[model samples]
Target: MLKRIATALWGKFESTAELKKFGFLAAIFGFIIGTYWTLRPMKDSIFNAIVGMDYLPWAKMLSLVVIFPLVIAYSKLIDKYPRHKVFYILISIYACASLLFCVAFLNATLGLVNTVQSPWRLIGWAWYVFVESFGSLIVALFWAFTTDTTKPDSAKRGFPIIVLFGQVGNILGPLLLNARRLGFANSAPVVAICAGLMVFSGLLFCKIT
Candidate 1:
């Protein structure tokens, strides 16, 4: 019964080894991409809620300003380090940033930090820019890794399944963030979960030997 399902889903590969390889890559890439998509919406929500609708245009402009230097630095990193090492650095930064924001959001909710005031609003604006850059950079790096590791022929057979799995992640990501049902009515837990996912994705990247 399971075999039939596997065959139907993946189609028959030329060898069992090839099938296993494709399945593993698909699962890893899917999880990473999906987790990313989940955080994408949350980022927007955070910015809008904390920074106000009027400030969003300014935030967008600020993000554009930040992205250029980041892109240049990322290009330099790529030139200097191995791809996997660069991925580690990127994910580590993301994990740390997520954790930092988790704390900030929690404090804001608890009235430990004033959301209406200067520093907190400034932090929110910075976060919005950082997340925008993080999403674009990490997703691009992931696909570059995918293309590097996958043979052209194998990619033809396997990339669609990988994307399919990622779409499932995209679906699940938003559902988990639903305010009422999962009880993620606060931002801290959501940010923490995203941090966990980022860590998990990093571990999976390490496993891609």
Candidate 2:
């Protein structure tokens, strides 16, 4: 029966409290991952649209150069603040940045329609790095925090649930953001939605704590 399948997958929870904790963790992971997946395609598409695909390789190289310092700064941040505080701070910062990008994308001169020029092209590169770092940092931060807080025994049961929900997010994120439904090729709306999701993911983590 379905009960057997559920037990086989998630294992039996010791109590309702344990089950609820696992559910919240799963939801938080799902939303974070979903937002990342949604942003992933836009990183490349928006970059190519605004900066020209010719510069794509250089933009990628820029990310490699940028990521080392970023990781070091992230480590210092973790040392200075509690993990939850780091999570809230990073999520808030990304949310605000996303909104800023959304507004920039709305501007004809600075947005996706502008011809690829040196200074204007900088925004495209920045956008690329922004989403790239977000994927690298936020996902890693979630797992680091999760494993830090979750007990090994409970993790055996709960991790599967979290992974399953994350996969669902991975699938649905792109599906729901399909351009045909959204009815435009502009990235501003998608960026705005991502900001909202990031805020929601932070709030969900608040509930988890």
The top-ranked prediction according to lDDT is: 2
Clashing pairs in 1: none
Candidate 1 deviant stretches above 4 angstroms: 1-11, 109-120
Which residue pairs come into collision in candidate 2? none
lDDT against the true structure, per candidate, is: 0.75, 0.86
- Top TM-score hit: 2
Candidate 2 lDDT trough over 10 residues, lowest sum: 112-121
lDDT of 1 by residue, 14-132 (tens): 66666666666667776677667767776767776776667778888889999989999999998998878898999999889888888887784522244563434676787788789
